[model samples]
Every structure is written in structure tokens, then in C-alpha cells.
Target: MNTRPAGQDYIATLDLLRLAAALAVVLFHYFFRGAAAEGFLAECYPLAAPFALYGYLGVNLFFLISGFVIAWSAESRSWDQFAIARFVRLYPGFLFCMTITFAIVVLAGSPLLSASFSQYAANLSMFAPAFGQPFMDGVYWSIVLELVFYGWVTLALFTGLFQKRKLELIFVWLTISALNEFFLGSGAARLLFITEFGPFFAAGVLVHHIHAHGRSLPALLLLAAAFLISCGTLSVTRHWMQNHYGIAVSSANLVVANVVMHAALIGAVLLRHRVRPSALILALGGLTYPLYLLHQNIGYLAINAATPVVGKWFAAVGCVALMLFVSWAIWRSCERPAQRLLRIWLGRAVDIGLARFRRVSTEAQPAE
Candidate 1:
């Protein structure tokens, strides 16, 4: 029947999938990485470590989903509109979560975690690393990558290339990603082009293109290439884990995990129609952002504090539940209302700036 949904249609399955990815990341931090060389946790879960070691791949899954969602979001939006949407979508939750994390770190007075006012102020810009201040939570490095991706998208939209030459752009991006990753190995290129993670994002965009438009041969081929490159790029993560955690994921295991994630994404889109959309599904999706932002450092502290009273496993479970609930509350009370207000204000400001620019251009036109 070829019942693929349009760009405007909400995919309830994706919402559920996003929540699952976020939970995977939470588990990774709590069960594996925390107890690894970092020693963020006092108690260790040796039984769960092997499985949770792979959970870090959830961030890769997130970039893939983001590529799809961002491509879909940009379909009919102007550059300014897209910018506003991205800002509204990200900044509110980020601001709320960052503030909450900062408050908790200060209150906890934990020797392991601390935040200063300058750090908080710099984090407000969401690029605290540039200002010689650390991110309050370590997970924010991924958020910065996301912002860079958004910046590139916004630039593409402004140039009209996003609509007219999206595939070409993806091709160029993938080539650069491969070159930098395999041959050049330039740190600057890696950061600027997101070479390490670009394939996941590119694969995601191709998935959306195939679903929305059709299975054109170029799209399919590019997708295959993206998948292959994405597998190769996991070595970067492997090396990172080795350096930090003293363990490395086997290449075969990485490939298998990558395949499963990509397949799951494809299946979610294909089966989205079978999953009914509801407020619950939407709310589950909404909490992922705040949960990701809030889970790492604060959660370490929560588990640390509660473990003494409730024991390790109980503290871990309780922390996850508390994080989920707080994330939901923030989504409902803070992100939703703030997004509405920010969208309206940012939209109006953009309109005013655009109108004034148009008037100035018109006045500058040559007359007969």
C-alpha cells in the first residue's frame, strides 16, 4: 500500500524509540562508565558492565534520529524559522536542565562534583568549553555537536542549497567525513565537519529521504556508504573507551550494534503507522532531552548519596525513576511553556528584522 507518512506527520514510534535511546545512555553512564576507570560510582555492577558498555552507542542512535527529524523539520521552513525552531526546541530544556544540574552540584557539596557561578554563566551560552569553563555535565559535548550540525543546516537553508542540493551536500559531507577519518586525521576537520559522527547523521537523512520521497538508487547507495562508514567510525569510540575506561569494544560487536540500531530506525519508520499517537507517547519523547541533560553528574551524585541508605542496586533504580519523573515535570512545566513564549518572541523579532531589511533593499533599488 506504500503508506509512508508525510513530513508533517508525527511518528509515535520514533518518540518511543527516542525514549529507549535516552534510557540506554542513562544505563551506560550508570552501569558501565561510572564504575569504570572514572570511578564516578562507589559501587560497581560487573554483571551489567558488558551489556551497558554497548549502551554508549545510544548517542550514535540519537544522531541518526536527529538527522531524520531535522531533515523532516526543514522540509517547508525558512532559514529563520528553522533557526527559531531549533533554538526553541533546544535552549529552553538546556537552560532549565543546566540550571537544575548546577543547583544540585552546589547543594550536594560533593567532593566529586562542583560548579561555580562563572561556569554556570558560561554554560548558559551552551559553549562553555570555548570560554575555558567546563560543562556542568560531561554529556554536553554531544549537545555541542548537535548545535554545530544545526548551524550547518541553517547555513544550507540560507543559501537555498538545502532544498535544491541536499543529496549533493550529503555526498560532500560524507566524503569529507571519510577523508578526515581515514586519511587526513585532522582534529580540526573532525570537529568542524563532525567527521567521526557524520555518517550516522547522513544515514539518518537518507532514511528520511527514502521514506518521504522514494527509494531512489542514489539515496540507497549513499545510505549503504553511510552505514559502512558509520561502522568504521566506531573505532574512534573504541579508542576513547580504551583510553578512559580500560576496555575496548570488539570490532565485530560494534558492527553488530550499529546494524541493529540502523535497522531499528528503519523498522520504526516502517511500523510507525501501527503505533497509535497519544499524549503519553509525546510526553515520553519530550522528557528525553531534559533527561539526557540531567542524568549524568546529578545522577552520579544521587546514586552516590542514596547508595549508603538503600544499597547500590536500589539506589541506581531509584535514581533512574527520580530522573524520569523530574524530566517529565520539567518538560511539562518548563520546556513546553518556555518554547511557546520563545517561539513567539523570536518569530516576531525575526519578522521585524526581515521587514526592515526588505524596506531598505527596496529603497536601494535603481529607478528609471
Candidate 2:
């Protein structure tokens, strides 16, 4: 009932959800994962393991939010505005976090997680596979997925294939995703087309379409299909968890997590204008990106060092606080400033390019 025009302003509730997602991921890395003892935290903090066991669900939540937010972001802008906004939003924080992680890993003697120059250089591209290296931090995989999602969005915008043709796009994407994820299980498809993770993003897009366009029958059907596909394909994430953590995640828990995530995301959309936007909401949202980018590898190494000096409980706690602080500092110092400057410069560039294109078009009119 409180829905505003698409892309008019930020949906503040999603900011709160972003904070929750980031915190969930932190908890997941700290406790639920088998690798907790492998790097930082020294040993699994058994005290929190019970509570944190399902925190990995946060990534799925983040993906859902990303779909919704990105769709909303592109709704009322030219391709250039969307591109610049995304670049400024993502890159500076990424560069800072990656560089810091690289330095810390190099300085620390953690060979298992240590970096090579090639790896660091590859990571600078963000799409590290192009340069023949893995992500600088394990957490970066999600961000890579986000970038891939952005690329497709850009293509859709460039071709002007969205809106009038959105349902068709979603159907084709869902079909490809289903084949790759469920039937063919092609890793190449998963990476190139984001087939494995397409449903979640699709779900988010459907939510946006429903919200903005008043939930037409066809859109509702597509939304239902997308949700079911996402729910059905969740086992991919479950299998990965099992393989990595050696922990059996019950199917029921997975269902519940997905269900809750769905409800939460939809509720946020429904409450978009119902909830008052505030500086605090904006601030919290602003910090989530930097927090996520900076938290994992560097935090692990920091925890590994501090755990010895301060003992396990104090070390983990202290390091969590420190990482949060560092994240805030990065947001305030690096990310926000970079976004401002980059947006200004990109605005000028876009204007000049548009001017050039207009002049060329005028020159080519041929006295008509």
C-alpha cells in the first residue's frame, strides 16, 4: 500500500536486512564452518555453535536482497547512471578490502591461506578466474556472483530488453538455471549464466515487478515458479555446506531458512514506505558492504594472532569488535568518499559522451 515509484529512493528496510545478513555471515564463518579452527577463532567457540550453525543462510538472503535492490536500482535510470552507481558502490570498498587482506595474508605466515602476487593481481580484476586465480578471500565468491548479476542487468538495460520483455527473460533464465542446476549440472553454465544462483535473483526481480506493477496474474505465476525453483535448488548450497563443514544440514532447516528469508524480503518490500527512513538505516546499510568485504580473511588472520595474546574468548570477541570498527572506518573513510568522487567524475564523463554522440548523430543527419 505504501509503495512508491520504482527507484525513487532507497528502501530503508533492506538496509536493516543487509546488516542482518552481514552479521549472519560473520557468525557462520566464526562458528558453523568446520574451518573455524583452521584459521581464526583458534577453536570453534562451542558456546555459540548451536546458535550460529545456520548463519550461512545469510548469503542466500543477501542474494535475494541483491536481486530486488538491483532491479529497483535500474528501474528509472539510464544504463550509464546504473553502471556508474554500481561501480562506485562496489569497487572502492573492494579495492581497499582486497589490498588490506593481501597485505595481512602476506605478512602473516599462514601458508594455507597465503597469497601470491599473481593471485593478488587476479583478484584486482574481481573476476579472478579471468586471470587464473581464486578469490582473494573465500567470501569474495558471493561478490563475484553479484558482479556477474550486475553484468547481465547491464546487458538487459543496454538492449532495452527489460520491462516490456521481463517475463520472457525470467522464463528463459529460469529454464537455463533449472537445466544447469538440476538436470545438466554444468559448472560452466552455473558461472557464465549464474544458473545456480539465478532463481534467488529472479525471485527478487519478481518481487519488484509484483510490487511496482500491482501483481498481475502472469507476474504472480512467474513469482511462484521462481520461488519454488529457488526452494528446490537450495540443496546446492546444502551440498556445499556439507562438503565443506562435514556437517549435515537437515532439509527442513534449509526449507525453514529459505521460507524465513522469503518472508523477510517480501515484508521489507511491503513495508518500504510504511517504515520511516532514517539516517541510522542509511548508515547501517552503508556499512554492510564494507563490513562484508573486509570481515572474513583479514578478520580470520587478526583473530588467529590475537587469540594467542588474549586467549580464545577474549580474542574472538575483541577481533569481532575490531573488524566491525575497521569496517566502519573503511565505509566512512574509503567507500563513501570514493563513491562521491567517482560519481561526480562519471557524471561528467557520461555528459561528454552523450554530447559527442549527439553531435555525431547531428552530423550524420545529412540535411534531412
Candidate 3:
């Protein structure tokens, strides 16, 4: 979504996208949480299961946003500055969230305590991906992709490639994706680094770049095509079809479908920004992070707590609302303060390092 000029600071369409992704994830987790069908509510309804199947697509949208936001967030910066900013922005909030999740698990009779120290250490460092093992905490696997992208962005910035050869770098990444997914037959690897999703992110960057360069309809159309192809490829996975429609489709065709749909959706949203963001839309979008993290487990927890009274749908809604409220409070109280402190500290540390480097260089200079 295009960032509007300053003073407005509002883009209704992106908020809508965020809200839609959050809902997709919430619905996905609602059915897939535990006990398979979640009893009759899912089994009888049948509609809920499809949501669960498609829910994983939320991650793709996120990758797209990350690509756009990273560039958007750091449009004017030195490499050190951008890296420092990204670190400060992500780590403090992440650590706090991790700690919160840890506390909850311990209270909920965590099996983790019985695990070996090596196992515990692996989790603490977010090492599940390296082991090709699933994690105890459900949301963590997604972070692996985000972190990889962060590393990629940092490397690009350090080499001045982000500034100098941006388009070339994007092409190189797309080539790697095609090679890995098709030639190498490494679907898992393609999914991991979000190599397959790179085009979506590239589209986001292109959105901003084109807007900055003055908009052109033809350029946007090409971007739309790229987005469609990328998303289509992802949608046709065997797991997605079986779980969603109970009918398997060839991945080759699924890829094409995903690409077409993603492009169309993004284009529609981008073109429809004249509409204002309603309060409800903002509320839903605001819940996205908490929904992403807590949807699965919270639904289970809610079902257990409200067993006598609340049913599945009620439990799902209540869990989503409760998690959203809790997350909002945490964001305000903990996340904000932590981020502010991190920024100050990171900036000061960078300044000190620069000063020390200058001092050393001055001492090494020939007498003048």
C-alpha cells in the first residue's frame, strides 16, 4: 500500500489487507488448533476447514509487507543506521513476546522442563529450523523466515546493493527461487527463506519505487502479474488442496491460480484506497499480531476454560478478542517503552563506535 503524504499517515487499504490476513490466520487456526475437527462445529460446518488450509497464506502477505516496509522504513539511511534501526525495531518486542510465551508455557505445565538442556537451548536460540523440527511454540517458525529476510536486507545494505543494484538483486533472487523450487525440487527450502515469496516483496518495493518515480499504470500491471504468479505457485501445495477443498490439485496449476488471485486482490485493494478505514477495520487490523501469535493456542485454552457454556464459534471469537486486547495493552505498556530505550541505546552505541574508530585512525595518521 502506498504511504500517503505526511500529516495524514493513513492508508485505509493496507489496513484492510492487514485485517484480511489476520482473519485468514485466525480462521485457519480456529479449525486446525487441536482435536482435529474441534468437534461438531468444524465437522458439521465443513467451511471452517478451508480457512485453516488457506491460513498459511498469511505468512506470504507478511513477507510482502516486510519487503515493502523495510525499504519504506529505511528509504534514507546509511547501512549501519538501517541495520541498527531494524534491530531496535524487532528485537526488543520479540524478546518480550518470547518471555511472555515462556511464562505462559511454564504455568500451563510445560513438557519443556523435562527436556534435556540441549533441547531447551535449541529452542531458546530458535534453532528448530536447523533441526527440521517443529517447535513447541507455534508462531516461532514464521520468525525464522522473517529473520532470514532481515539478514538478506542487512547484507544488501552493507554491500550497497540495495541502493545501487536493487533491480538486479531482485532478479537474482527470483532466478534462485525458480531454480530451487523447480529444478532442485526443494519445496521446503523455497518456503523457508521465502524464496518463492520474494516476488511479492519485490512488488512491494516496486510499489514504493514506482510511486516515488511517479506512478505508471503499465509498471503496476507488470508488478501485478509477478505477484499473481508467486502466490499461485504457493497455493497449489498438496496439503492446501486436501485440507481445503478435500480435492487435490496439481501444484503446477495451483501455482498459477495463486499468482493470479494474489495479483488481482492486491490490485483491487491498491485501486480502492479512496474508501476510509472504518473503526471496525482498524480494530481488526490492530489485533493482527496477537491473532497471529495466540490464535491457535488461545482457542484451545478458551475451549477448555469455557467448556460448559461456550461452544466453538464463541470460543474462537472470545479468544481472538481477549488476545487482541491483551496484545494491545502489552504493545502500549511494554513494547513502546522497550523500543524507545533500545533506540536510544543503539544510537548511542553506534555513535561511540564511530568515535572510537575515528580516534584510532587519527592516532595512526602520519605527523602533520
Which candidate tops TM-score?
1
Candidate 3, residues 188-301, lDDT tens digits: the string is: 767655666667776766666665555666556656655654754474356654785455545765565456445644563466567676766555554455456545554555
- TM-scores of the models, in the order given: 0.97, 0.92, 0.78
RMSD of 3: 4.6
Model 3 whole-model lDDT (C-alpha atoms) = 0.60
Over 4 Å off in model 1, which ranges?
1-7
Query: Can you write out model 1's per-residue Cα lDDT over 1-368, one digit (the tens) per residue?
Result: 00112347789889888898999999999999887887889999998888898888989999989998888888768888888889888998999999999998999946988899999999999999999999989999998899899899999999999999999999999999999999999999998999999999999889999998999999999999999999999999899888877898899989999999999999999999999999898889989999999999999998999999999999998999999999999999998999889989999999999999999999999997
lDDT (Cα, 0-100) at 84 in candidate 2: 78
Error of 3 at 109 (Å): 4.8
Pairs that collide in candidate 1 are none
Q: After best superposition, candidate 3 residue 144: deviation in angstroms?
A: 1.6
Residue 301 local lDDT, model 1: 90
Looking at model 2, report the run of 10 residues with the lowest lDDT sum. 1-10
Which predicted model would earn the best lDDT? 1
lDDT of 1 at 181: 93
Every model's Cα RMSD, please? 2.8, 3.0, 4.6
Q: Which stretches of candidate 3 lie over 4 Å from their true place?
A: 1-12, 33-47, 109-136, 186-193, 215-225, 228-232, 239-287, 365-368
